[model samples]
Target chain A: MLTAIAIVIIGVLLFLANMFMDNYQLRILNLSGIYIILSLSMILINGFLGLFSLGHAGFMAIGAYTVALLTTPPMAKQMNYYLDPIVPWLAETEWSFLPAILLGGVLAAIAGFLIGAPVLRLRDDYLAIATLGFAEIIRIVFTNLQSVTNGSLGLKGLPEIEIEIPLPLIGFTLNLSACIWIAAIITILFMVRLVNGSYGKAFKAIREDEIAAEAMGINVFKHKLLAFVIASFFAGVGGAFLGNIMGTVDPLMFRFLLTYNIVLIVVFGGIGSLTGGVLAAIVITAAMELLRFLDSSFDMGPIAVSGIPGLRMVVFSLLLMFIIIFKPRGIMGVREFSWQWLIELPQSIKNSSFGRKKLRKDVSK
Target chain B: MSLLRTENMTMRFGGVVAVSDLNVHLDKNEIIGLIGPNGAGKTTAFNMISGVYKPTVGKIILGKEEVQGGQTVTVEKDITGMKPSAITKLGIARTFQNIRLFKELSVLENVVIANHLRLESNWVSSVVRTPDYTKKETAMYDKSMALLEKVGLAELKDEKSYSLPYGMQRRLEIARALATKPHILLLDEPAAGMNPQESDELMRFIGKIRDEFDLSILMIEHHMQLVMGICERIYVLDYGITIAEGNPYEIQNNPKVIEAYLGVDD
Candidate 1:
């Protein structure tokens, strides 16, 4: 019943936002939705599996490029592929948004599997560095793949994804925002289901102690690979959404900075918490957009404050430092949103004074 | 055939011999002990048998199964260099001296993870939460809780494993090993840090699990009281070589054992 209420509320809010909100606000919302998917993916590898991976942006780029190329109109493909025409087969095949997004995710998942097979053996900083290298390799490949990706010129005039489904007795039009919201909700739900299950328990076991996990017959390597591949799949889907919303794609857009921004969000939300990932993704993305003023020049009456290039990043780093220094566990730590917590909150707070006294008595016993 | 057998087992680290040409065997439904002084290669021998260290040269036979005369029988096969999980699947389970429980997981989760080897639900079913998946999980949960109860940890099943007291953590380790349903239990100094009272309790616990779980046991221990009290046969090692092997009385009285435990003239 609570889930039903939540879904209905989300659906109502989505419809209202689509009808009332301007395109700029709607675009930001869409981007945040995509980030929710990506960050959830990152948390799986980095948080649950305790593997330091820096390849999400690479996966996203693969996903976005796959969607961009597949869904681009044949005319746009002809215009963009001036340097070297896109391969005959790919240029000719114009796929719908759904299959195109799935293709993007599948391709990214394949890349993740290939990369994870070799580097999943590495742990800690080494794995981070290897994944970072893979991201760089993917970037370079996109830059040089003129025929497929249109090289540095990038691709524009990407098609918008439009799909509408009707529900009987509940007349509603599901637009792009609705689609994004639906995907985000599904991704969050899927992640929650996974992280709360036996398989998720196995991942946490491996994270806590690889040797112990292996001794318990969890197959540590296989679990790590599973996380890497699944996370990649979601990251890819998120990327496809990003391309459709932005209406452009470029290799430069998926630099290490993109992955680093996601890392900041993951850490900000707390590792091993799916709710944290979703919440932090939206908050961080909104803050990034709102903090655009820091990068722009402004005047305080007679005093002119000249804008600094990359000032946004400086502020971001400062925020990250503050969170790490003060609340190192991030907003949620490893704790999830539980109904029991809600029921117990008031009672616990009221018990604080007497609870302190009673705790000492129990411990002394 | 013996439940476990090692023939001419040796382990070399660089130029140093950690364990050298040690031959030993344990029959079904028997308890055996490996004891030695500090740096006596006792743990190294355990490591070899448990597949933590591949032997430099040896035959380590983990029991295989066969049916004989309408009854099941365990036959020995050379499992010299198998992965630890593979060895675990073959019904050999072990606990480390370090008490390497999944500390962040709840006590019940630790046991359930060990039970994962027996999980028949595939990824698709687990994701979809099909009746098969949910049923298996429910069974696993009940089974894990029962194991916790037997270990006297049912009340603390929801607690983080690391937050448990030291003795309870030690018991949790043993419970985790038993969860795998191994044919043989290899405990590497399970009683290492336990006090005399705790070690005594551990001895009873060991015997109880042996009978209850139908296990053949091989453990490395420095606790002489526990070793002499419970072990049917004991092997003594000194500097990677077996110095003595006999019944408890013979090992206790052996002059070489005394020399190794005490000290010989340089």
Candidate 2:
């Protein structure tokens, strides 16, 4: 019941913010939603399944390019020389935002299935290296595909998605930000339902022991492939949102840094916890924005210190190192946020008043 | 009729012949004991029957399959070269000598996963978590719990498998193998590290399960007392070849068996 109340409150706040906030704040919120989706995708593979895949950015590239090619207007095809006559039917077809995004996800899933077939056979550091090589290969393919991806020049002038809802008191207005936020919330809810299911249990089992899982008739390879495909599908959708939001698609945009950033976010949030992933995405996204303020000089009473140009990254790296040494499992460990925590919250509050009694009980126990 | 029969099975790892011309047969509703000193190829024979290692030369027939023609039959249906998973689906299941339970998962989850092979639900049903899948999952949980209870591990159902006491871990391993509902079960040194009391209890537990599940068990044990107590028929191996096979009375009095155990009696 408390969870329901919290959901309702959060929904109301999002709706109000969408209605009242300026375009700049709305854009930041949309970025947060995108990060949430990407982080959840990472959690599915790395956290639950214990597969070290550094090729998420490769899947995202496939998604971004797919969306870009399918959704580009016929008139603008001439301007984008890289847009070939391949899949001409889709180019001529006009799909709404949702189906196009879903198609992008499906394409990415296919890519994941193909890659996971052979690579999932490798173990530990070997799997990591294989996935990293796959990502590098994907980047190179995009860069060299002059006819389809426009080479390094990139694609531009794609149509922006506009979401509008008719309200009784107010006039109908464009609300793309609301749509992105809604997609993010839906993704989170879907993942929560999935990870709580039997398939999720199988994935965790394979992670713990592949040989034992197989003896138990798990079809270990099949479960691992499922995890990879599902994770890649979400990554593709997130990539499509990013491409549409930025109004451009370039091979150069998907660098190794993008994959590294998402991996860092997943590790910082705690693996295998969807709630932790979402929370980490929000915190990291906001922190990156806030660090921009440090660019200007600040004066103290007796001294002044300007923000060093590359100091932010150094500080961030240090924070990662510190977290690994102190809390290797991250902030939440493998636990999700449950209603049990809320139930215990009031008890903790009451215990503060009778602290001595609580202490005595603890010692006795 | 024998449920599993391996004729002239031989496995060679490069220059080292681990098991040579090993002939073994397992009848239905029987417990067979495999005893040997270290490096006597007891595990190698088990591995060959379980399809972990393809025998260099042999015929392994499961469920009355025939052996036609010469020593080498070229039929594609040979069970000797099949994968371990395929062999398991053919009513053969084994526990590792080292206790390879899925350590991070709970004991219940581990056993339930083993029960998944018999489930009628397909991949689509599992992904959507359909009502049918949920029902099957519930049934599997109940059955797995029952097995755990039978093995005296009902209290550790929710604990991570690796966190259980060593004796409980062995019991859980057997419970997991039984979850596969195999016609024949292979236990690799189930009493490896148990105390005498635990070993005695394990002997009784093995007998009870054999009767209850109607299973054919092939176990490798170094503990002679446990072997003598539980096994209906025993096979003693020396250097990859069976030296003696008979009832407990015959085995205890055989000169060759006595020599094998007592180092030739000087």
Candidate 3:
């Protein structure tokens, strides 16, 4: 019940924020929402199922390209696919954002199932390397599939989705930012429901001990595949949202660095904690934006200096290092931020630090 | 006839024969012991029977066995090469020698996860929490709680399984196996680390559960006291071959059993 109330409150706040925030702020908000979806989905596989997957970027590329191709106008496709005309069927057809995004997610899920079928059987580092290799293969495939993905030139001028709901009072346009957050909220609710259910327990069971889990009648491979496919589905959707938000996408955009960033978020948050994932996603996304200045080249007196290409990631790497050193279990460990925890937060904070300080002061006196 | 029978089951790991042509039968509600020294292929046999290792040769059959009629064991399912989970669904459940409880999970959750084998609702229904799923979940919760109560871990249902004392952890593992509602239960060294007093309690606990759950138990234990006290029949293996199979008294008096255990009288 508290969860539902909190979600509603967050929805209302996002709605208000949608109306009030400027374009630049709203872009960050949308990016944060996209990160939330990506990190939470990654958590389902890497954290919950104990499968170390580094192929999220590949799935995202599939989604972004699918959404881009399906939603772009026929004239736009003709202009975009100049070197090699898009396949006739794709060039002529256009779809609304919802169907395109759903198709993107479904395609990505299918890809996930195919890759996971063989790769999920491998454990730990082998799984990670295989998945990372698969992602690279996907990116390279997109690069070479000239007629389909417009080769390395990439896709641009993708339409922003604006959903309008007619209410009794007035009709409000659900802009791209609003759509991203709405998608994120739905993704979160789905993840929460899944993690709290029997299937979630089974996933965790696999994480705990694959051999025991199989002995207890969980088809370990099946559960691992299920988690991988579902995570890929949401990652695909997140990718679609990101592409629409940026209004452009290329093969270069979906790289191992993308997967690395999301993995960092999942790690910085507690791996198995959904609330921690959410907190880390937002904090990391905002922090990355805040640290953008570090990457920006400033005008020196005489010499011209180009910005450092990936300074934000370096800063984030340091931040993650500090997190690993200080709070090895990440922010929340495996514990969630529940309403009961919220109620006790003040007491806990006092007892852990302030109360200890007071006792030390008294002893000193 | 037996509830479960292994016919010429053998497992050869490349050059080494781990278990050679091992034939064993378990009757309904019978307590059978597989006893051997360390590395005597007892666990290897358990592994083959529980579908962890597919036997290099022979069949494992599960079906009805009329104790009084002396009929042939009916060939219901030849689960020789099935996956462990599928074998479990066919009513075989097991506990690890090392107490492989889902350690980070709660005691109740450890048991509830076993119930997942028999879940009727799919992930979609469970996630949506439809009426059917909720009813199933509630029933699963109740069943898990009842099992915890039976094992005396009801109070610690919310505590992490790893936090429980050693004896309680063993009991929780048995409770978890019981939650799967298996007809055949394989316990791998249930009394491994227990003190004599605790093993005594475990003996009674094992007997009580066999009667209560209508289960045939196959256990591997080095604790001879517990084995002798509880097991109606015992199989002794040495170097991957069965050295003796008889009633505990008969096995105790067997020259071959003594030779194997005492090194052929020097």
The most accurate candidate by DockQ is 3
Off by over 4 Å in 3: A164-172, A297-309, A346-365, B64-75
Candidate 2 yields a Cα-based lDDT of 0.83
For residues B136-202, write the lDDT of model 1, one tens digit per residue. 8999899989998998999999999999999999899999988888989999998888899999999
Order the candidates by DockQ, highest first.
3, 1, 2
In TM-score terms, candidate 2 sits at 0.89
Which candidate, 1 or 2, would have the higher TM-score against the true structure? Answer: 1
lDDT of 2 by residue, A162-184 (tens): 64455788856555676677778
Estimated TM-score for each candidate:
0.95, 0.89, 0.95
Q: What are the chain B TM-scores of all models?
A: 0.97, 0.91, 0.95
Model 1: colliding residue pairs:
none
For residues A219-313, what per-residue lDDT tens digits would candidate 3 score against the true structure?
A: 99999999999999998999898888889989999999999989899999988999899999999888888889778896677976679978777
Can you write out model 3's per-residue Cα lDDT over B47-76, one digit (the tens) per residue?
A: 999999999999999885434567554556
Highest lDDT against the true fold, candidate: 3
- Binned by DockQ into CAPRI classes (incorrect, acceptable, medium, high), candidate 3 is high
lDDT of 1 by residue, A99-206 (tens): 788889999999999999999999999999999999889989999988889988889998787654557887665567877888899888788878778888889988
| lDDT tens readout by residue for model 2, B53-81 | 89999989886334676453322235888
Q: Kindly report which residue stretches of model 2 are placed more than 4 angstroms away from their true locations once superposed.
A: A1-8, A80-94, A162-175, A294-307, A348-365, B64-78
